[model samples]
Target: MKPALFYLIFFGILSGLLGCKKDHVENVPPGQDWTYDPTPFEIKAPASFPILNIPVGNPTTVEGVKLGRMLYYDPVLHSDSLRACASCHSQERSFTSDPPVLPHVNLAWNTSFLWNGKVEGALEDIMLFEVKEFFKTDLEKLQNHQDYPKLFYEAFGARTITHELCAKALSQFQRTLISGKSKYDRVLEGTNWVFLTDEELNGFDIFFTEKGDCFHCHGGILFTDNSFHNNALDASPEPARSAITSNPADVGKFKSPTLRNIELTGPYMHDGRYETLEEVVDFYSEGLKTSETVDPLMKSLHLGGKHLTTQEKSDLIAFLKSLTDTAFIADTALASPFH
Candidate 1:
């Protein structure tokens, strides 16, 4: 063939091959793409906080956190439609309700979850329990919903929502609930121009010293060691950690919840036995009920407790209140999307 004619035929074949690629795009339904890549969301935490161990398979994304926040507040997750994760965990109360419900703040650092440590491991592990065992979420409702299908698709690259995906999404949001802006944290940073009162300072001393004996389990950046302990709440308390461990020594042991928002997360302790911070102080001061499972850290059990004086009790309570991070409880991002 002549040079011009040969060139035309070769170019025509190349054009035809390109046309085939366009056919696949044409075959796809409107607005539907085969590839799904959500935007990565970086979690912000304080300098003193430990590095988060996010699951490789379930990284936090902007879309995932948004979906998770909605799921967290929506009552639709429950079969009765009368309760939501937010029902027991309210933001105003530092994501906690009356006792047995712990605050959600700084959960990213926790290895054990729940009052009794029934679930342990990553945040996703506890979230799975929340989705499957706690909520018993019906996938059919989510699949049929007008918003969830699209939300799931954008968040997880899947239109079919499953319990596992639900758990992962919830975990993403929970991981972002960092609470490190309290007065105590400000004092630690030494840059926020915030200082504790004389009473709070005295209480801090008591808390860190053997006088209060609180630091043994409640110390750390997160204000909790994330371990189970039988704090001598009762001589014969109900089975707690034992239920999960099946060990007699574990009985009456409960997880040490974060005190980041201790002022707001009241009805204190595993059973909500104490109504006020004063009562909680009084119990540790002189009312400890010793038992076989009492934590060794409760060294003052022989003396009937810490025997904190009336002024000391007041000061200790003042210090715990210093941990209330107003910024965390009022963050609009963590609040209910519906609200």
Candidate 2:
């Protein structure tokens, strides 16, 4: 061959390779941008609750949140293909199951997932460790199949699921699960779609008053202290905080949950004992079972015997209903992606 022709052919191939590289670079999606819209509703956090501290490494991003949402609703993470995180933490009930009905008798409707509020860690931790363990599958199988390892690389800059990346993605997705725009929120925002009846207003007053004493633990936009407390619900004299910390006094304590959608997220309390809010109120009013580690806050209120007038009880329920955010429940963004 002529030297000039051979040189031209080599250079042509090199140019083609360079052009292909450029196209590949162009086609790749950019890293996620972390900013999210925070204006729809002011979180209205109570003075007692601190600003929720999110981790620094996994900044909130649209892409990361989307990926987390996909993972959240995907049952692929489960071993037998039976459960997704959503199976227990259902979106319809504020990311909690209403109540599981077993064979012979109906189980009390408690909040979802692990019994002891042990799943309070980052969502990624729950998904990777807790969930994967539940399925009892091998780690390699999880990493190799389903393109999950590739997804981890894309969402987070890692090829494998590190605890930090998983937590970041899960937390980012959770932060997006905001439950604003309830009837109570509307009333707070001065909307006229529905007016609070006088009785409900009275119930609201009672809820905030010393007589009810409910506000101490359940005050704030999220309606939780965000601190662990022992409500003395356990049958055995077990120390709650001991599990999280070996401190003797810490036993029997559990984290308080948000009351945003309380009516739907029943039967009430840590153990799911109360079927009705009325039962819950009555317990607080009178059923203060004494225990060595009982919360100092749980003093006899002389409430149940006095009896909330039927109208007052109804009003209190109405106020609780006001906490339910219908818009959140039906949000397409949070729905199961598999469907």
Candidate 3:
């Protein structure tokens, strides 16, 4: 069925399920009705996935995830109702902005948020910034929305519509965005998966070896060491990590995003300059910018790039595409619940 039709039907059934009569919790709040579901919010991930670093105060809950899913797709978060967090961070692109902007995959493991590591409080801090600073959401409208206030009440009983609730619910839903069904994952687990082509194998070797030297930062199940570095985007100073720290030594340093879905998350780099995977690979292969903060992994400052052959670059690109998780992007649970 078409996704829109499916979404409408699915949510129709969900609304019926949510309509079941239940004993309302006895909240002492004068005029507030409080209800909290005990449904466990199990994060679907492989057994090999690392332990989730969820904040103690904000454990995942069913109502929270439902509210968050709505908030994510709700254009009501923006004053003009023309954009949403999902307007930029779309599920089709693995919760990343369409610009090949840094994605929002596997963020429970991330210690910081955004392409720049400046925001250090919590993942909710990102929502606080996106709604308040970046997009300027009309909270009054959100509170007065047909369903948002009700959903917020369901998620956080007695708490009126606030940015904090928005962030918390959004964070709950985001933490559930686990992408471990890629071919790379299956192959690594020694499953009876499709065998890698020799070109892809060679590319993998190149990626891990000193020749490609990509593993240091982009390695493991998450595909990121989750650190800030100047990957030599340009020689001129760019407002990067330093914009947060104001440390001159941190100039041009930006957080290294995961390469899990690298195939689709282009144009590559902090500025979204490169348009294609070929351009990105070719840049790392021959167009490394010499910068004071350039990552030491780039190696041999005089040599602009990794200097991979054309065929090697092609193979590398193939290996990178292997990381794409078609199932993750198509997950109905992650789709817009409002549709």
Candidate 4:
């Protein structure tokens, strides 16, 4: 074969291969050597849980999660240098600090975010808002950090640190915050010979059945429909989802948070009004206030509430407490890497 023709054919094939490559490779910094090999990670969930939908561009990886975990607990992301994603979300509380702050567990399946569902779409979408708008992350700070640049490069192969990369790393770590091993999960899986007490069993019945009328919004394996509701918290309460939808009918509507780890997720409700599970139960039992936008699922609203007996409330509280996963709270992986 002619030498000229051979060279032309080889170069054409090489260009084609480079063009066809899907994985993006970032430029390496001068005097620095780096490899873009990231260890793939699979998120673990219960058998009953649905498959987590990971974004094609951002696959979960060990390096990415490590960087993200550091970022989550580090105060570097905040302007004040004293707050972080973990400032409000602690692993011990199942990722929720108090009322108005929803748990970050099982968020891979969440279609919306925040108490009013202000942020919609995938986990990446919410993280984008959190990184760019909420956190106002200073890229220059990350770039100037002694360790972050190397960590970011190792995780994302990006020589430059941007909010997008930060958000992606944060999302990667948050996606691993799965919480499906509570006592309720054991009952479903029939593992460890774990069984609910009689009182808790009665509470479970009340929760799932119409007796307590709790299942309509808080049912399912996640213990939440991931939808907004009023639940008649007040007759003319402050606007909630309405702020997002701009619909008067959405007034007082708020996302029905997952009941998992409910024992530690209070002060209950969006306003942090109710301090204990007892108060939350009492409100649902006889303290309901009428509202035009109140959810239709609150069938007992007319009678003021579910009207559960005192013993039933105790039983229901027992069942709610059973949802707490002690293992999740103590998992060292979820704890602050700094500590």
Candidate 5:
């Protein structure tokens, strides 16, 4: 062969092998980096409740959060046009609906979120599911709408409402709904401006004491363990865990919600059985109905007998009120973008 041709052919063969080697290297799995930008809103998050793990595709951004806020308040997502995400998870109420009802008992309980606690999924997933449940519609159906496809294209670089974008937008918006600047937090941070009266101090003692024993499940900054437990409120011993795991031992278990804004997120419990803080204290104090699945932590609390003196109860309530962050409920950044 000619020297030039021979060199060309040799180099070409070597290049082919190098190309194959490069392709093989590329095929190897790369390490997964799940980090994303944290929510921009300011709040007093516990170290335990570390920045929520946002999915890789849907990162937190001011524009994306704005789009999510718009979607959250849009009534068109509902079948009846009467409800929006904000309708059920109102900002004023710490994103939970109040005044829960029991069908068989004709009883009204201070409810949190939907009638049942079944809606306690991830904020993004819940938003997507609500839309689907309302109209039996998915992103495909949404794409056929007059302006939805266009909106999606603008928000997510696509003309279709994929589950990824739906979840991302909603999650970004919900993350902005943090509420941490309460009077209680100020007291904890050693701000003398929030002066707790003697009654309030007494109530605080009771809350952490053996008589109240509320700290077991409601401990930590969020005031919830973020785990599920059965407090023995089952009427028929139905298996609650069957829905998720089909395990008999998991029956009647429910997630513990945060008590940051408990005053607004009332009719407490998974069923919204208690209406007031006093009623809730009384339940722990004197009204614990026993069952096989009762949480081991829930010993019968005397609440220092008589469910605390009236003054003590009032003080406890005052402490709970200190947990409410008025600034969070009125944050313009979280409000409907349309407004």
Candidate 6:
């Protein structure tokens, strides 16, 4: 090679290296001051949902949300430190371990928590029990951990970590969990979307009409009235709400959980009795058992359920599967924050 050409190549390579260095992005710590121009959080409500209601005390913040996301996935919140809230309310199964539990959703508007609606408290308060009872969190590990103290300080302006701060951060993170980009949402949103299949449309009709009568309980944008009812699952489900409230009316009643991601959440019912959507559909179609405290909406009980045909049952199952949001469970943002 010519001397001049060799020199030119060397300089060109040096320039490329400089350019690459300049283009590389650097990791930076987020702003920490809780009061200084705090980052704001808001939701883009789906077509069916109204404005999301956030608690004034726990206004969402970027730092707080990040902290909450970390805490949510961190097993350090558990006694075993091998289990986290995500162990049960994981993303893959729509934030629920199995059928009976509903995936976490827009709880900013929720009036109750848990299966029986016995937990009547702010969304943040749920974490208090989760840490104490469900997860059996160890406060010593949290307080002594190198990263937790700093995270707690940034999120709550406290140098020391506490269960309340943990709950607050969790609540902040959970409130951001909004599912509205399903195929159905796109159909409602409009554009060049495929129309619902004939079977799905028929199932929708049955669900909304008196024949199916599903709309009354698990209806609306969130897919639940968020009310309690004796779904006629039993004369009384064990650890029954009746035991807690001493109200006979509360017997056999459980919170009508959201069906937003019903497809992924299966083994339906509080006891996870039915393993598949087929069994669940069949139950509503022909297997309505009479319970003393059955909700009035169970009008079909006097007869024998909707008596949906086999094809109709399949169609209804297809409609329920449409509620699954692949993007939601696959979102990296909702995954374990440790990585």
Question: What TM-score goes with each of the models?
Answer: 0.90, 0.74, 0.87, 0.90, 0.72, 0.85
**All models: lDDT?**
0.88, 0.61, 0.81, 0.89, 0.61, 0.78
Model 5 misplaced stretches (Cα beyond 4 Å): 1-51, 99-128, 133-135, 138-151, 234-238, 301-309
Assess the local accuracy of residue 339 in candidate 5 as a C-alpha lDDT between 0 and 100. 47
Across residues 85-167, which tens digit of lDDT does each residue of candidate 4 receive? 99899887778886458888889889999989999988888998998899888888888998898899889888899888998
Against the true structure, candidate 3 reaches a TM-score of 0.87
Error of 3 at 313 (Å): 1.0
> Measured by TM-score, how close is model 1 to the native structure?
0.90
TM-score of 5: 0.72
Residue 333 of model 2 has an lDDT of 76
Ranking by lDDT: 4, 1, 3, 6, 5, 2
138-191, model 1: which lDDT tens digit per residue?
999988887888888889988578999999999999998888998888898996
lDDT of 5 by residue, 1-339 (tens): 899999999999999999988887786423122223344533234343445555555666755676677777877666566677777667667666755321110001112223224555455555556556654434554666665565555556554476667657766666666666777777777777676667767767767776566678777676766566776564454565446656666677776666677777788876676888878866655566656676777766222233566676777677677777888778786676674
Badly placed stretches (over 4 Å) of model 3 are 1-34
lDDT by residue (1-339, candidate 2, tens digit) is 999999999999999999997887786543233223422212232232345554455566665776667766776656676776687778777777646211000001122224345555444444445444565434455466656666666566665564455545655666667676778777777777676778768878877776565677777566765566676564365655567567777677766666778877887766676888888766665565555666776545223222566676677777778888898888887787665
* Model 3 alpha-carbon miss at residue 189, Å: 1.8
User: Which ranges in model 2 have alpha carbons more than 4 Å from their true place?
Assistant: 1-52, 98-139, 146-150, 232-238, 301-307
Which pairs, if any, clash in model 1? none
Where is the poorest 10-residue window by lDDT in model 4? 22-31
What digit string (tens of lDDT, one per residue) describes model 3 on residues 1-339? 899999999999887766643223233332345455536687777887888777887888898899898888888888788887788888888878656567978887887777778577667787677778777877889866766776777777735788777889889988888888888888888888577789889989988888898888897778898888888878785979988888888888888899988876777788788889898888888787787878787784579887889899999988998899999999999899875
**Residue 275 deviation, candidate 6, in Å?**
0.9
Which ranges in model 4 have alpha carbons more than 4 Å from their true place? 1-31
lDDT of 2: 0.61
